[model samples]
Structure formats: C-alpha cells, structure tokens
Target: MSSILRELGALVIDADLLAREVVAPGTPGLAALVEEFGPGVLTPDGELDRPAVASRVFGDEAARRTLEGIVHPRVYEEIQRLEAEAPPGAVVVHDIPLLAESGRADSFDAVVVVDAPLATQVERMVRDRGWSEDDARSRAAAQASREDRLAVATHVVENTGTREDLRRRVEEVWADLHAR
Candidate 1:
C-alpha cells in the first residue's frame, strides 16, 4: 500500500526500514541490545539475529518493552529527520507497522491501515515468512488488537482481496486523499 502511495507521489517514510537501520551492526541501538540481552541477538557476522531476538522478546512483556524502549525513539528521530526533508505541499506518509501499539496514531494527519482478518494475517505470515502457525499467532498476540488498530484508522485498505483489487483499492484511497 505504501509503495502504491509512493507511486501516487506521496513521500512515504517507511518505519520498518528505519528500524533496521537503527540497529545495524555498531549503532547505539545495537549496542544497547547487546548490553540488555547480550550478543546472542547478533549473527555470526555481528548483525542483528532477528529470530533470536524475537524468540527472546515476543513471549515476555518486559523484554519486549525493553526492546521497544531502545528502538522506538531512534526510529522516531530518524523519521522526523526524513520528514523534514519533504518538499512543500508533498503528501508525507509514515508507513508504520505498529502505529497503534506505539501510541502515535494521533500524531498523523491521516492513518491508513491496510487491514486483513486475523486468519488472513496468520496464513500470510506462515506462508510468506516460513513461520510456524504458533509463532505467527504468538507474534500477533504481542501487538495491539485489530479493534485497536481500526479505532484509529481514518482510511482503511481492505487487504482481503486479489492483487489487482488491492491496486484498485489503493488507487481509490489515493484519489480520496486528494479529493479531501
């Protein structure tokens, strides 16, 4: 959806990309993780071992909070920096995976949630990411409920359809945003 928005001329700042950049190798985010959870969170080549970190954090509330504390601020700072570079009158979209959980839904001009049913989400995770159904469900449980996400949505891209349908829906949403 964000890619569609980008194609429609919105300046999309991707949080997922920033999340990875913040933790790359020798950055403070990585150092903090090493300090808090030890170097086992790192790959043999000293990069973040995401699965290892996920295994340790997802089931434990405190550990997840600790991880969030280190990463969120850094990502936000980078987001601010990138957004500041947007040209005047440009449509700036923050493509975030955890907007509702981050307590920042109110921060955006409009929140566009690409929503799928839980079954769809689970199936996608299991199929696309090669995660076990249990791990997928566990990860989903770690985040805010679907209701919480929907409560804050100003626009929703219903993602329970075919690829061409998604493109058409995104185009409609893009048109709606401009129509406003």
Candidate 2:
C-alpha cells in the first residue's frame, strides 16, 4: 500500500488511525468497548462483563445513537485534517471502512472497494484473529453488502489473489492516477 501511494505521487491517509486519533484520549476505546457490549455497560470502574453489557447496552437504540454522536465528530475531524494535508496532485485514498455508513461519499474523488468473497473474508479473519464463525459473520454483516460496496466503488480491487497480482493491479491504478 505504501509503495502504491509513493508510485502514485500520493500520500497514504489511514482511516483507522484517523478514527482512533479523533476519539478523545482513552475515551474512544472505552466508547468502542461500550458499543460492543451494547452501551452503558462500562461501570465507572471500566471492567466489562460482555454478556451483561450486550444484553443491556445493545438493546437500547438511544444508547447507540449517543455512542455514535460521541465518536463521529472526532472521525470527521481527522478525515478533514488528512484531506487538508494531502499534497498537490496527490490521489488521496481515504480508506474509510464506514464511508457508506457516514454518507460521506461526495467528499472523495473516487471510491476503491477492496473485494473478496464472504467465505474468504471469514476464513482470513478467523485465521488471523482466532475469531469464531459467528463473530466473523457478525462483523461481515455489519459492513455494507458486496453489491452496495461495488456500486459505490470507482475501482474494485479483487483482493482474492496472489500478492503479485494485487501489486500489479495497484501499480496499474497508480500509473493511471499519475497520468491524471
């Protein structure tokens, strides 16, 4: 990814880092954990009982909205900062996983969807993170569907390939971006 950014005369803007930075120091992680447990589960002490929290926090829609309100602004701030810092003639690829969720598509020149089959994605997630099938499926379901992602994508990167193939495609895209 770094190589492709260099080749395109562009700088890399990591969405995850931006999101993490946007959250108030330590609060984002707490908020994220609260979100996972379904809100309000974090006692002032910070120890989590996953089952108890999931039953209470996730069951309440108001709690979910409150959680989003706290984090979204920070994420937006980081995104704006990164966009402002992009170098001249740079094809800034903001790798925002929640672009669709945020309804912020118009902010980018183009969208690049990294495509892979659900099964492959699940397998990779499980192998990499030791997540169970249910966990993998839930995570996948949380993201936009394949068709929706493809619809929004100006370029579809089929990640179900060898590293060489992926690199080749990235190079091609980088060359095109450079030409523009």
Cα lDDT of all candidates, in order?
0.93, 0.68
lDDT of 2: 0.68
Error of 2 at 58 (Å): 7.8
Candidate 1 Cα outliers beyond 4 Å, as residue runs: none
Badly placed stretches (over 4 Å) of model 2 are 1-3, 6-9, 24-65
TM-score list, all predictions: 0.97, 0.75
Return the TM-score for candidate 1, rounded to 2 decimals.
Answer: 0.97
- lDDT, model 1: 0.93
Q: Write the per-residue lDDT of candidate 2 for residues 134-163, one digit (tens) a residue.
A: 777866776678887887877777888898
- Tell me the tens digit of each residue's lDDT in model 1 across 1-180: 999889998889999999999999889999999999998999999999999999999999999999999999999999999988999888888889999998989987788989999999999999999999999999999998999999999988899999889999999888878666
